[model samples]
Target: MIGICKSFGANKVLGGVNLHVRPGEVHALMGENGAGKSTLMNILTGIHRADAGTIMVDGKEVTFKNNKDAEEHGIAFIHQELNIWPNLSVLENLFLMNQPKTRFGTIDFKKMREMAEAKCQEIGIDLPLDEIAGECSVGQQQMTEITRSLMLDAKTVIMDEPTAALTERETDRLFEVMKKLKNKGVSIIYISHRMEEVFANCDTITVMRDGQTISSRPTEETNMDQIVGDMVGRIMSEYYPARTNVPGDEIFRVEGFTQPGVFRDISFNLRKGEILGVAGLMGAGRTEIMRAIFGVDPHESGKLYFEGKEIHIKNPRDAIRHGFGFITENRKTEGLILDFSIERNIALPSEERLAQSHVINDKKEFDFSSELSKRLGVKAQDINLPASTLSGGNQQKVVIAKWVGMHPKLLILDEPTRGIDIGAKKDIYDLMNELTAKGVSIIMVSSELPEVIGMSDRILVIHEGRAAGIVEHKDATQTRIMTLATGGE
Candidate 1:
């Protein structure tokens, strides 16, 4: 694509952007959340039309009418969000709207099974073909999407944050498959926020900022600092900010937190002003434990205490009433209402406080939301814009602002910075320090080991739904945490 330009009303998403991918090469696309990467890809796949641009596929200029048209032209896009049908089986999902038939006009289940098994074996992934897609883990669902894309035999495949939901072992398997595909003369457009993965796996790198291409260089020619500098337009002196908040006496404790078949014997504690990092492999019940503690899900047996006194939480309202806030992992669905304005979403939890005699005070709500949004450094034209209009980083800031407005003693942040850029990540870390300084304890559940080690005063490693070990900041290392997370001693 050359000179691609797109506009969404007054917002110019892509401004004369350019991208060139060689055949059989892994090209990495690096950018902040609103850097026009997604918009460019959407235009390539015909999800949106470019105001001005030209695309050349195999030296022939052509335009795609839709994603299906792009697929027909040997270009496939695997979105970050898995497009799996929850009610259908894995096999059914793999062949939805595209299935082979026998001479008698009947679906060929045998052929589908054989093809799926072959693809799974080739990718070194084991998926239950007959199981419901909804019943599978996020990693499994991601693999299902990858397998479906590979089945298309496309020449160019666009992958957006493919490993976000995968385990270390699964990620290794995916890289192996990517290598094999490259050897087969297939081109790949890799989009991710992981600097290490991009540097290690990709052959070339392209950075975009504010709807324009900043630079495109060979992976060997460019360094991380330069790429980060180009993306955020500044040099990051430090990736994780310093923490000065000293943890006080234990203010929250959980004893023998169990959820029967899900998790068992989960136990931990949090100090008055501390960030406790929870680390584990995907599907290791880290999220489940937090969900149960926050009353979003039930626990069969557990004991909760706050300020040295026993307490009971049967639901989220009770948890909130007792000064607990939970920022869920899936922010789009559980954290904020996309259609609601930023002010409304931020003021959601504080409705009772912002109301008088069962009626809301619009001015108070607006002022409260405006203050928190500015405090969190949420970048928006106006507070009345819908939450969906903000970038991922800004959306996350809104979620934090919403919970922070409630003045919770203990805040649970699950995957707090999952899909944001490095610049935004530093902003969040700084905000966390500010909150901790103000005496708010935090329990952060994360998959990124560096984040766990960087921000946590103490790290809890969960293995197979059990508490493997808890290591202090001075004693924590990626290897040690990974060992404990994978059922090591």
Candidate 2:
């Protein structure tokens, strides 16, 4: 893509950007949130037409009318959000648009199964072809999407945060598959926030800032600090801000929280103004424990206390009534109604408060949403735009704003910065410090070890549905947390 320029209404997202990827090379795209990386890719894939640009494929100028046109040219995009049919089997999802048919005009189940198995083997994945796509793990679902692209004989594949939800083991397997593809002369455009993944896998790096390209270099010619500087347009001395609040009295406590086949005997305390970080490998039950505590998935047996008094939280409504708020891991699916406007999504949890005699006061709702959105630094031309129109980081801020409007004493954040950029991550960390200074207790579950170590006052490492141990911030190290997370002392 050359000279790609795009705009959403008055907002110019891409301004004459250029990108080039070599065949059989894994090209890494680095940028801060809202930096136009997604916009350029969308234009290339025909999701949106570039206001000004030219695309050349194999030295031949080409125009894509839609995603199908791009796909027909062997340009496949595996979006950050996996697209799969929950009710369909893995094989069915792989062949969703283009399925093999027998000579008699019947579905070729036998041939489909064989092809699915072969693709899984080629991708270094072990997945059950007959299993429902929703039942498969996140890693398996991601692999299934990649398999679909490969089946289309995609020559240039674009992967957006493919390992965002994968475990360390699963990520390793993905890297192996990427290498195999590279060896087979398939070029890949890889987008990710994790620096380690870029340095470990990608051969070349391209950095973008604001709406234009900043720099492009070989992986061996650049370092994380340099890349971050280019993406954020400054030197970042600290990844996390200093904790300013001293712990006060215990604000919330859970004892003997148990869920059959999930988390068991989970006990923890959240003191006033404390940021309690939870760390563990995937499937270690960190998210399960938080969901149970928030009453989204109530535990089989548990005792909850707020300020030394036992309380029963039968459901999420009950939990909310008790001054508890949860920002779920998957924001699109659980945290926000994408179709709703920003003001509506921000005021969703506090509808009753924005009502007068059961009738919503539009002025009050608008004022409250505006206040919270500004406080969270949500960048948008109008608060009436659909929530889906915002970038990933801004959408997360909307979710946080929604809960902040409720004025909850305790807030739970699950993978709060999973897919956002470095600048956005710093913004969230600063926001956490501000929230704690204002006396809001936080319980954060993160897959990133560095984030857990940097932001937490104390880290709780979980292993196999059990609490391995809690380490203080001063004592917490990546190695220590990994040891405990893997069932070591």
The candidate maximizing TM-score is: 2
- Candidate 1: stretches off by over 4 Å: 377-394
TM-scores, one per candidate: 0.96, 0.97
TM-score of candidate 1 relative to the true fold: 0.96
lDDT over C-alpha atoms for residue 139 of model 2 = 71
Q: In each prediction, how many residue pairs overlap at the backbone (N, C-alpha, C within less than 3 A)?
A: 0, 0
Write one digit per residue (lDDT tens) for candidate 1, span 1-489: 999999988978888998999999999999987788888998999988889989999899989999999998899899986789999999988888788898999999999999899999988889899999999988899999998999899999999999988888889999999999999999999999999999999999999999999999999999999999999999987899988889999999999999988899988889988999999998899999999998999999989999999999999999999999999987877999999999999999999999999899999999999999998888788999999988766888899899999998999999998878888788889988988999999999999999999999999999999999999999999999999988888
Note the residue pairs that clash in candidate 1: none
| Residue lDDT tens for model 2, 69-94 | 89999999998887999899988999
Whose lDDT is greatest here?
Answer: 1
Off by over 4 Å in 2: none
Q: Among all windows of ten consecutive residues in candidate 2, which has the lowest summed lDDT?
A: 119-128
